[model samples]
Each structure stands twice: as C-alpha cells, then as structure tokens.
Target: MNILFVLLPLGLVLLAIAVIAFFWAVGNGQYDDLDSPAWRILLDDESKPPKDPKDSP
Candidate 1:
C-alpha cells in the first residue's frame, strides 16, 4: 500500500510528459502533408532503372 503513493505519482508524471510531447508535435506541424508522399511513390523516378530491362537475368 505504501508503494502505491510513489508509483501512482510517478506513473501520472510519466503520462503528463507523454501528453506534453504529443501536444508539442501537434503544434510543430508534424502531421501535415499526408497524401503527396503516397502519390510521389507511384510516380516514375528517373534515378532508378527501368522496370522492363533487357539486362535482367
């Protein structure tokens, strides 16, 4: 029963720290720009070799 006092407050403090980090990420625009990356992945990138190449054995 005595351990609950210390452990409970420690757990609450850790939870509060996690909440602060989540809010910091939200305020810093970390969630912006979701779709372009998916479409960009489908687009043909010039740096990579062509898919239907004769050299492939």
Candidate 2:
C-alpha cells in the first residue's frame, strides 16, 4: 500500500518528462524532413567521379 504513493508519483514524473522531450524534439525541427532522408539513400551520388589507379602518384 505504501509503495503505491512512491510509484504513482514516479510514473507521473516519467510521463511528464517524456511529453516534454517529445515537444522539444518537435520544436527543434527533428521531424521536419522525414521523407527526404529515406529517399536520399536511393539516389545515386554522381558528384564525385571514380578515380583510376594509374592516376595515383
């Protein structure tokens, strides 16, 4: 019975911390570009050309 008082407040504090963290992430632009990162992996990087072994000193 005594443990309920301790556990209840601890649980509420944890929940409050989680809610604050979620809002902080949202305000920091964490979820702004969700799709671009996934699509980036599929796109080929053509900016740099492959170097040949003969070109090395």
Error of 1 at 23 (Å): 0.5
What ranges in model 1 sit over 4 Å off? 48-57
lDDT, candidates in the order shown: 0.91, 0.94
* Per-residue lDDT over 1-57 for candidate 1, one digit per residue giving the tens place of the 0 to 100 score: 999999999999999999999999999988788789889989986876668898666
- Give every collision pair in model 2: none
Top TM-score: which candidate number?
Answer: 2
Model 1: lowest-lDDT 10 consecutive positions: 48-57
lDDT of 2 at 52: 85
Model 2 ranges with Cα > 4 A deviation: 50-52, 55-57
Q: lDDT by residue for model 2 over 1-57, one digit each (tens)?
A: 999999999999999999999999999999999999999999999865449867666
Instruction: Look at candidate 1 and give me any clashing residue pairs.
Output: none
Q: What are the RMSD figures for all models against the true structure?
A: 4.1, 2.8
TM-scores for candidates 1 onward, in order: 0.65, 0.79
Rate residue 41 of model 1 by lDDT.
82
